[model samples]
Target chain A: MNSVIFKKELKRNRKNTAIWTAIVVVFTALILSIFPSFSEMGEEMAKLMSSLPEEYAKALGMDEETWSSIIGYYGTYYGIYIILLIGIFTASTGATIIGKEERDGTAEFLLTRPISRGSIVWTKLMALGTLFIIIYGIQTLSAVIGLLIFGEDVNWPVFTTMHVHGFFLVGFFTASGVLMSSFLSSKLNYMGPVVGLIFGGYFLNAISMAVEKVSWLGYFSPYHYLNLTAKNGVLELNLITCLGASVVVAVFLWISNKRYLSRDIVG
Target chain B: MNAIELSSLSKFYGNQCGIESVSFAVKKGEIFGFIGPNGAGKSTTIRTLLGLLTATSGKAEILGMDTSNEGARIRERIGYLPSEVDYYSEMSSKELLLYHAAIYKVADAEKKIQELATYFQLELDRPIDDLSYGNKKKCAIIQSVLHDPEVLILDEPTGGLDPLMQNRFFELLERQNKKGVTIFFSSHVLSEIQRMCDRAAIIRDGKITAVEDISTLLSKQMKMVRLVTTSVNNIVLPVGALNHHQSGQKHTFDYVGPTQDLVIWLSSQSIIDVTLSEPDLERIFMNYYQS
Candidate 1:
């Protein structure tokens, strides 16, 4: 996968990795640390949640039966924050990795090198591709460590399902972000659109949950895939949803490579 | 066979023109100059050759390989220094050079990079963002030739360098040419082109107005003649010498036509010393632009 470019991308992205990893890991730990208090006051919390508007509770992913279990507790409380952080971390990084060369006027230096655009795009994708695995690794490790320090009786299968499903869910944005970058004629062209699309996908999930007429809007949001509270929070992922997300990721990545091959890189 | 060739290469950005049907060729082991003013398509032609921007319509070949399809292989033997240089801002000069070395798989790259660094007087350990414009230009020059490629494509390589550094760079280029490297030197600076190029192609408005040997290009258009005579009043003016100026015993002017007539006239005069040479490319460039 063009090891030279892969290593160069690694060096270019080291600081980004450090900043985002710290934000996600520390943020996840902080959320998990409150689990003991959540467990002690579970009944009062349920009453208070029920008294709140049903739409607000559902939009915020507050489910009483799901909250009774540790994994569901973690998923409902911490998953959204993790998703947003990763969505931003992946999308912004994906959008800018190739665009940076154009922005800094370094494309002339690089494009003249003895490498095809296919190799260039894929190597950059491969570099950002590792961040998905890394952030996932850090999340899994930090969540496990947090669970040990704050609670008991962890739901191992469900926790693994939530994170695994989360990866595919967030990967769609990452691929789309890269594809958007490939189509931009200028460095500043696609970044705002990418961030807007991410937030649009996020709020669509909330709006779809809040309004019955627009429930189908949830289909466009990665957060709604394999709904974490489904089937009594046992973490059973629908095979159809998994297959569909895979198709989307593959399509976006393929299109990104193809578009990058011919698109003029301008800044 | 030509080392580099372009036939009707055109690039249009939307309705605006970048270049239009530009064509030229450089012989093997030749130092070819490309001269034009800003926005006159010098960069567009070179960028097309390097495969950085695909041409709208044309055929381009380098080292017997098509630039459109075989860019990677063509670039393997080519070194390019762009008009304006920029790189990863956070990387030090040493780090950037090493990165290129690894990418190009350069042999004994450490020694080569160190040698160029010293030659350019570049502080290798300082971050690129901390370097001055001239220092960055030095880094660009060093990287372009560090691989010792068979061809060098330099665009305005001396923009930010002082006179001394520019002189050293010219010397470096001469050394490389002696080793049989084909060079395509592009500049808007006429004096540098006059000083360095063996052959030059004058491009304007996206077209090559003239491609001629430096000698023929200058001699056909104008020659600058300087002569020291005991009496300026005693000199007989040649048939087509223009803009005569005299200061004490010296007379200078732009001359055109046969050297035989000028020599006969010079032998008749009480001459002290005389020097005849091609004028700079500026007047020729102006003629091309105006016409």
Candidate 2:
């Protein structure tokens, strides 16, 4: 990877990365900070859970433990909003990191430099990975702090398992964003499509869980395979699914680099 | 070996032609011009040579290295100025030039950037997004040369510059050429080519129609002849005269033969007045373009 391009890409995306990380951190704190209130009235919370339809509660991955424990409550929203927020930031960034050069007509200048196209793509991907780690790592750290500050008897294993799943899920979404951008026009506004893709995957999993008649649809969404929601206040690491998603991510990045190398950079 | 060479190089967008079987050579330390109108495949051929567009077929080489595989290496020794200046708008001109210098690993880049910026009369601190087209072009010029490359590939390099900047640019190019740097200058403006190039290839409809020395092109014996003659119902025109016109004995035609033959023919005419003048490169270009 070319360090010049790598550093430049990172610097270019720093402001956006900071803004998104702030949003993710604030939301993490807000959600965890509110969990104590729910737990304070556990008896009433149990009744609230019972009045909700079983299918609806199941679809949201919420149970009695959701209010009784901090991990379960955060897990419920992690799949719905936390991961989606981080995924949208990372995925949209992945989509535009290399493509923005083309859309702005700066590819001509950059491509003419004494660097191979392969090196440029690889370097840009490295920068994207670094950005992904920054946002993801910060959000995870904030969650840890918030859990410590606001909860009692926190399930560390379940939280770790959920974050691991979060890592692969956001990674899969980010890779998908890169792959999608390579196939689309460089002039495209990638935010709409990137947001659509991440939100679409989450809703697909959500919808499949809400209705038994269409549960088979869960097989198609990455969210379905990489479960972000806990079961009975416990979440298990699906090593096989994570490994499989890792391979898919690798393949997506490989395809993106290949497409970038061979494509014409028109002015 | 030639500093730059193309062997039947072609680039086609599926069925549409960008440049077809385009071929030429520029010797080391020579200023070679690629002259063509806009969309005449001038930029396409340059893009293919620089590896910005994949060649559909054939080959290109710079300083004895094949462009297809050794593009990065070739680029290390070459500087390119695009027809349209498109740079990172977020960067100041200084930052962009430093970035370029870093990519090339040029030593003492900050000093060079300062010098070039001063030479071009550019304000280095302003963000590129705030710069006008002319200022951007100036920035582009500085970046192209800041690394002291062995070759310079310029496409319409004077587009946004005023006359003074254009002259300074030409002067800079001449100095670079003197330092054994080969230049591949591309322009649609005939006068610029005439002023700077030693030899030029004329391209039209995506193919090279002619490659000739600038001196030879200028000294082609083609002259625009206008003669106002006394009344004569019939007159025999010389063999090389073309596009003859007569308006009440005010005759005009382009003569392409020896001057002596034209003088002898004119001596026999019932002449009232006569004028013979050399055509500018623009007229000569039109001749080739139409042909």
Candidate 3:
């Protein structure tokens, strides 16, 4: 990979990355910091959970344990908001990272540079990975600090499993964004489609979980296989799902690189 | 060996033609011009040569390397100035130039960037989006040459420059040429071609009509003839004259043959005033178009 291009790409996305990272970390802290109040009223909150409609409760991944433990409480919101928020940022950024050059008429300047297209794509991907890690790392760190400050006898294994699943979920969404951008026109506004893809996947799983009649719909969403919430205060990472998703991400990146290499740099 | 060579290079957009069967060669250390009107496939050929667009057929070679296979290596040794200037809007000129230099791995890039910016009288601190079109063009020019490339491919390079900058640009080009840099200059302005190019190829409708030396194009015996006769009388037309026009006592036409024949014919007329001059490159270009 060309370091010059990689560095430039990273610098180009820095502001956007910062804005999204701030939002994610703040959201993480807000959710985690509020857990203390919820745990204090655990008995009353369990009664409230029972009073809620069973279908709606299942759809949202809320249960009796949700109010009893910080990890359980955070897991419900983490899947619903935190992972989705991070996914949206990464997916949208991934969509535009390469196509933005073509849309801005700067592809002529870049493609004519003394670097192979393979190197260009690889470097940009590296930049994308770096951005992903920065946002993801900071948000996770914020979660840990928030838990330390607000919780007692935290379920560390459940928390780790939920985060591992969150990693795969966000990664799959990011790769999907790269693949989608490769197939679409460079001039397209990709935010709409990127948001739709990530949210749509979540809702598919949610809807199938809430309705037993259409449980097969969950198969189509990556969230179904990569469980983002714990059951009975326990969550375990699925090795096969992680390995399969890695293969899919690799395929997606390969296809994106191939598409980029053959595209004409038209102004 | 030729500095640049195209062998029947063609580019087609689906079934539509961008350029077709175009072939030319630029000798080492020569200023070769590519002349064509707007939408005449000039940019298409240049883009194909730079490997921005894949050729439908045939091949291109630069400095003994095939462009399709060795584009990155070939680009390392070449500098290209596009007809339109489009750069990263958020970057200042200094940042953009530094980035470009970094891509090429140029040595002493900071000093070179400053020198070129001074020569162009450009403010390096201004963001690209805030700069005027001419200023952007200047920045483009600076980036194209900052690497001190062995070959320079320029397309409509002087569109936004003032007369003074244009002169400086030409002077710089001449200096580079003297240093054995091969320059491929593309423009629709025939005078620029006539003034700077040793040879030129005229393209029309995606095909090269003629490739001639500058001296040969000037020596074609084509002259714009205007005669103010003493009276309205029958004037014997020269055989080589074309597009003759008469308004009152004045008669004008393009004379394409021997100068002696035209002089003899002029002596026979009852002329009050007569003038003959070499036509501008526009008329010469039109002659090729018409032929």
Candidate 4:
């Protein structure tokens, strides 16, 4: 009921959110700074690509010939890593924002106010959603700046599409974190599930590349939707899959709210 | 109307124990003190009344509405302060109060926050992380009562305060009570309750062992008595009517029966000096705990 409380919660976490955004921006700048020099070293990378097996090339999201190109490097290497980084950071922050209060014995104070428990949970979720969007915006802006500085001939639509996919991935991961936080009381308890999901998804995607027969495994990971190499070097918008994942997030949120409202805050 | 009521209320945590078969009612304009030692279910009962925990059996009603069914409505009119007050350390006292004010839909929230900050002499700009424990407790107390709730439920509200702050806290409660707020506070500090509560329930091991007017509870349970005799020969006292210890030629007894009956019975003994004293809450509390 109290919308201002939601804004204040977002403000409370603003410092950490800004720190993460700055880290992402700095990392992007550092990666882009090395791009223009890659042209001079293209021959060396081509030789390295040639020495690799076909499965390795595909797993790395590269073709043997294009492995040396800056665009291919960004799309295949930096793009996946950046997406994963965003997902991991967002999920960790989102999951802890609400759960940490409980763990620290602060939930009692918050709940004793005239606000309803459902409203508190909803406000926290909204605050996390706002932080996720802000982080995504900062990352997208930093990428655009990096592309401009590197003097790359960028396709605006393609660039925007890639980030859109990243946005969905980040959102899904944030929801996953919130869902996990509802079940986990301590930060330590959350680490195992979170690390398992991120690394498990990446490894599953990698395994799908090595064994063609089990290539379907990639579809199970949110990382699969982050394939910027396909669709003519642009992100392919998978409406059905995105919607399915969104539905999953919604269901998780509903369960989290219901569970939170019903359970006694023992901490 | 009764401010709050619980009938056969019970709560359990898995296989562990919580409150069991607890029941009491607080009147609309009384300061009701819940006295108990640690883990005696005082907090559990308060949480159940606030609808923060579901009762495994029986019923709890607040403002004539079922606690579970109308918890939000009940919360809207009730102010609560938990035993341990924790807040977002990054937020300033002003920010925290404003946030609570918004959630509570307090009228003229900014003004209300300022008024509370001024009343408590709180530093509005200082971050919560930097404040001392007593200051943090003040912030929590101010936030809880800022909305001018109809009922106030405070758990150990003055746990960490200095004597001056504790006295000021009592003054604040008295002021609120004057404004017709129904106060239900839990404390292990007997003197605080003695000075503030109109009625009280002494709880032990999750049960309300005694619930009566504060004066009646103190008068009936607390006592001081002395007896003297010329001969210290074979002086034996009644078994169930009194609890006593003797020194040289004097005897002292404490009990919960009528003083006249005790006086008359003592008069029947050999003529000597005699003395009687009223009960103190500390002794009554110790007896309740031991029982």
Candidate 5:
């Protein structure tokens, strides 16, 4: 665990972290600000949402019953955007962290230093994990602050569970990015594939949710497992998709370590 | 103890060959040169020695530690300067230097970095992206030697520098050699090898053709001789005449024998006229290869 490399990575990506954190938090605050209007016209909004096609509503992952509840409202609307923003953040971060050394022609310098390949990978990954924690911390803080300022009543347990489940989903894409970065020889070349995977999983989740025959497609996207529809849902630490996503993250990190350690490192 | 040793080192990229059967050893306190043309496995050999690439069939040891299994430990006392260098675009030269120094755990990293920066006349505060290629090369030089490692591995380290900077860099290396640093220099520049190295290995087509003292090898430089003889067939060709070519009344070939003996033999031939010139690296290698 090299603190130097870890801190260096943190400092290098601070700007991007700041930008994404702001996007997630500001969006969270804006949605929470509309809680008053939403509660006042709750029945009308419920009719409008229910009258819409079930397919459209399911594709959008919208739950009309949860529209009046503060935490449920937060999850249905802001939760989707949160997952999307975190997806972009984690994917790009994971892909670029280690590969930028190779792309920028500095791997020769870094690898030649008195550091083990495992140490380098773990340190960079640690920094990446730290970034996620920081972003998530800021996001949760913003949501709680918004709830206090605008909402009549807030469901703390549901809100916490929503953010916690969102972490696992975002983590899935971040791990894919890490694995993708290990194979990339040039700068930002893997961004297309990583971002594409995130969007693909998102669409697959939508398709599986709206259609009855291919519900397995929902498993592809970690976003599908979020507790967005469960009003005042019990905070469960264990979910099958969460376990599956954790395994995927561990597998990618392991592969990234192995591949990077034994890689030929051309150019 | 040998500072660096490689035995039958081979690296294959799938079916393609990177380097094959490259064997050499550099004694402590010596500057050994690895010479070869591009794609001749110079970089491959160096990369294998550094544990940047694993060997398919052989073994390498640096400071008595196996390169494959003991890379990090071996690198503790090794300094490497690659042919082309790039660092974080956002990092100023000073920051990058400090970061590298921290990796090596240099106690007085700032002072060492400043010393090298001063000698190279590089702007330490400038971002790497803003620096010119030559300036970047200067920083790389500083980075490689700042820790004063016991072993220094440099691959074409003078590519972007001007003649003046090259001289300064060589002088710095020489100074380090005096302090007992082993230098492994890989380059295609014969003149540079002649200028600094005590011994050299000539590699071509992924094989080492010769490893000899630089002075002794350079002293035996191959010479090309062309003779316009009255009777080419009647004349007796001296020993070491190679790759003979005949056209009408003219005979031309390369010679790698005693210059005095060649002059005496030429005096006896009924030669119309004769011309002698120094041969290039290929011809020189051929003379050594054939012998």
Candidate 6:
């Protein structure tokens, strides 16, 4: 991929990154400020957790009470919300990267340049990766500040592992969004398939939590990978399965580039 | 060396028609005009040349290289202006041109962009979204030519420009041609083509019905003579001549035969004045379409 095009794309996305960063920082700060009271709230959550069936505990990673005790107040209240927020933000950015040029009629202009279609797609993906890193970095920094102020000596390795798992989830969903954006012509069409996949996956995971017999269904949701409470509190994954899924996404992107190079530029 | 060559080139969208069996060749340093109506596949052919869309069939070559196989290399030597000047709205005009110049690997890109901005009378710092339609078109033109490609393919390059700016654009094209650049442009405006192109092709309904030297096509196709006489006398005209009434005592006849015979025949009557007008491209286009 050409660095010049990649840099240009990065420059174009600067405004969007700045705006999203501020919102994320403010939200993180606000959530962290109130998270110290979670210890008192944890007793109630523990009672609520005890009443739930075994499947619900397994799905929410509540197998042991100590899993909630280690992270203290803020972790219990804000953990899932943070993961969902990062996933949605990353997916939306990826979706826009592929569709924005077409929406603005700039695709024809860009295609006319001496760059290859493959290079264009690669540069867009790289730019999106950079944006994801920046957003994630800002959120991680804000979390560290919150931990410093709240007098919590957190386990650095565990915290890092959880955030890393969140990053991978973002990457996976971003790839999905990029593939969908390639196939769909309009932004609305692109959003429909991606949003459906995300919400449907969440709904399936939730239903699995409510019923023990279908607990295996949680494996179908990428959220299963984000559950970082297993064994040593390290992010675990079926590497072979994840690699296979990534290959499928790569194939989709390749096919998308082929179609883009050959398709007519519709108004 | 020829800059572009298309032989029996055709493109179609499923059952819908695009350009069909269109053949033309543009020599180096020549300004070739592609004249057609809207939806006449001019843009389609241009896009195919740019490798933005694959041709359904037929062969096209740029600088003696197959357009499909060597699209990136071909694009390195050609600059194109799409009909709609869509650009990154967030970028300043200078940034957009520099970005394109870098992609084309233009040497001394910054200097080239500066020169083009000055020549086009565009403000380099203005964001593309803040510019007017004509100014946006000027920016698009500047971006296409900043790399100084050997061949320039422009679709409706002056569509939204004012008269003064249009003249300036033609002047810029003339200057580029003088510097040994080949230009192939498509436009619906015949007068601009008449003023700028050395040769032109008229496309109708996805087919190029005629391709000829512009002046020669006009001269051969537009052969109308108007005569004013003292009386309205019934004049017997030869077959294949178009006779039309201009006024009570004036008449116009369009023909392809020798004009000397018509002049002699008109001299026999009490003629007041006779005027021979050169053929117009618009008239030829109309006749070609009607047929």
Leading candidate by TM-score: 3
Tens-digit lDDT track for model 6 on B107-175? 998888888778778898999899999889999888878888899999989988888888888888998
Find the number of clashing residue pairs for candidate 2.
0
Tell me each candidate's RMSD, in Å, in order.
3.8, 2.8, 2.5, 3.9, 3.4, 3.8
Error of 3 at B133 (Å): 1.4
lDDT to native, each model: 0.82, 0.90, 0.90, 0.78, 0.84, 0.75
Q: Provide DockQ values for all models, in the order shown.
A: 0.58, 0.86, 0.83, 0.62, 0.78, 0.68
Tens digit per residue, CA lDDT, model 1, B4-87: 998988998898788888888999999999988777888888888887787889899999999989999998899999888888
**How close is every model to the real structure, measured as TM-score?**
0.90, 0.93, 0.94, 0.87, 0.90, 0.86
Residue B176 shift from truth in candidate 3, angstroms = 0.5
lDDT of 5: 0.84
Judging by DockQ, tell me the better candidate of 2 and 4.
2
Kindly list the per-residue Cα lDDT of model 2 for residues A143-237, writing each as its tens digit: 99999999878899999999999999999999999999999999999999999998788777887998989998888789999988777766789
Off by over 4 Å in 3: B221-240, B250-286, B289-291
Candidate number with the higher lDDT (1 or 2): 2
In model 3, pairs of residues that clash are none
Interface RMSD of each: 1.4, 0.6, 0.7, 1.6, 0.9, 1.4
Error of 6 at A10 (Å): 0.8
Instruction: Encode model 4's per-residue lDDT on A184-238: one tens digit a residue.
Output: 7654557567767777887788779777999999988877765555445555666
lDDT of 5 by residue, B1-291 (tens): 999998999999999988889898999999999998788899989888887787898999999999999999999999999887878889999999999888888889998888889999999999999999899999889988988899999999999899999999999999999999999999887778888899989889888878999877765666799889987474567887888889888988888777887899999888889999866666677686676
Which segments of candidate 6 are over 4 A away from where they belong?
A: A41-79, A148-157, A187-192, A213-219, A225-245, B105-111, B223-283, B286-291
Q: For candidate 4, give the docking quality class from DockQ.
A: medium
TM-score of chain B of 1: 0.82
How does candidate 5 fare on TM-score? Answer: 0.90
